[model samples]
Target: MIAISDPIRIEPWNFAPERSNFPTRNLPNRRAEIAREKQLTTLIRENNRSRRTCASKIAEMAKKAGIEVKPLEIEFIAARAGIAIS
Candidate 1:
């Protein structure tokens, strides 16, 4: 529950399989972005997929299609679609 200017991901504890420690909780004064983040996280949990997994899949698929997508861009696209792609 802390404010962070940039996104900081926290891994789930070994003992807590159902939770993760996300450091970036909110923006300075952007409620909309915060809400979207919350929603996106929820969607990720529901899908039972990790950010890395989604990003890798995206990259691989794009590469196969000769799109040459970058990691950062892939992650951003996944996030917008409610995917937890790092």
Candidate 2:
């Protein structure tokens, strides 16, 4: 009869999942909102300047043509010209 061989043994160990101690906040979304607001503000300012320039040009043209035009009338006409303020 042949001699019997010993069987291999395996070791067992305890494993635990990792945990975090700090809470997370949605900071990136807030930053994006603030950035969009700033961009809109800048666009409004630029649009206002452009509107004023266009109004001034119209007033100058009317004046050179010897036509009577009031400042309030020019302002009203310019206000009717819509700008993409968004």
Candidate 3:
């Protein structure tokens, strides 16, 4: 084994958690940008139910109103509306 003049090139790779190669399953939700979130928050507050129930109800409402919303976004909206959705 003798390699005095090898034409091999190698580069060091830095691992960054924020800039990973894998793509996220869900896209970023417009939590504050959506105007209807306020209304949805109100609805969530009006209903006296658990987190899962509220999420399902809000999803149904959003579906009926032809609005695209996710369960996580609902939690954010509820929090922004000053409602404890824990």
Candidate 4:
């Protein structure tokens, strides 16, 4: 027969990743790019327009609204949003 003095042991976790050996990521911020993609998606769905037309329209509107947006940025947004570039 075996006799155990203490059967259970409990330890508290601090949950500090910085203190522990956890790897941290240093990723770039892409909020603006993501926001632009969402806007492009909405515009495409609303008008059922092609990439070129949408890009031109967005550029014109941005120009009128005093926002500096380039045509290439629009193309990238369309591409990121999975819209067909025509």
Candidate 5:
């Protein structure tokens, strides 16, 4: 018989790379960019409707599979669906 004491051990590594020296491009006009952002927001909202439906289906499937789902997981799914949970 083997006694299991520690489940796992972790070691930290410092692997950060130095920043690049590439020159950035000039951004577009603020007003035009704002308009584009609004359009993107609308598109994201519309897409999230379908995503929410998918999330609900996934939750149902998880329940059927006997997997325990936490409220935080549900909230994360809701956030991805663009549905605010507060």
Candidate 6:
């Protein structure tokens, strides 16, 4: 009897173009650059809010990880801690 074999398959990944083959992105205009910088500065400036109370242990852990975390509402705290579940 003839042997049964799987048919050949075409994987799109094998034919994908390399990123280096694309042209480099153009730099943003001065106005856009200034806006982006300003937005980033605002985000960093408003990052800390000492409203909710965080656990001492959790705060210490965050500090050791180079992240200054203040306890938010329990919901927010749970969300943040969920990120470290792994």
Candidate 2: tens digits of C-alpha lDDT, residues 15-65: 222322221343565576556445433433444664444545554556676
Residue lDDT tens for model 1, 14-71: 4464323543443333566566556444544544354446655655665675656565
Query: Model 6 reaches what TM-score against the true structure?
Result: 0.25
Which residues of candidate 3, in runs, are more than 4 Å off? 1-34, 46-52
Q: How accurate locally, in lDDT, is each candidate?
A: 0.54, 0.47, 0.64, 0.60, 0.48, 0.42
How well does model 5 score by local distance difference test? 0.48
Model 3 agreement with the true structure over 1-86: per-residue lDDT tens digits:
97979888875353544434433422233433454766776667766365546665676677777777787887777777767654
Question: What TM-scores do the predictions have?
Answer: 0.33, 0.30, 0.43, 0.43, 0.28, 0.25
Clashing pairs in 4: none
Error of 5 at 5 (Å): 49
Inter-residue clash pairs, candidate 2: none
User: How many clashing pairs does model 1 include?
Assistant: 1
RMSD of each: 15.3, 23.8, 10.8, 13.1, 13.7, 12.5
Candidate 3 to truth, TM: 0.43
> Of the pair 1 and 2, which is ahead by lDDT?
1
Off by over 4 Å in 1: 1-52
Candidate 5's residue-wise lDDT over 1-86, tens digit each? 76688577664343323222321322344455556445434433444554544544544555565644544565464565466434
Residue 29, model 1, lDDT: 36
| Reference-based lDDT, residue 56, model 4 | 67
Q: Which runs in model 4 stand beyond 4 Å of their true positions? A: 1-33, 47-54
- lDDT rank order: 3, 4, 1, 5, 2, 6
RMSD in angstroms, candidate 6? 12.5
| Clashes within 3 Å, all models in order | 1, 0, 0, 0, 0, 0
Per-residue lDDT of candidate 4, residues 9-58 (tens digit): 76456455433333333122345545666765675544446444656677
Off by over 4 Å in 6: 1-28, 49-86
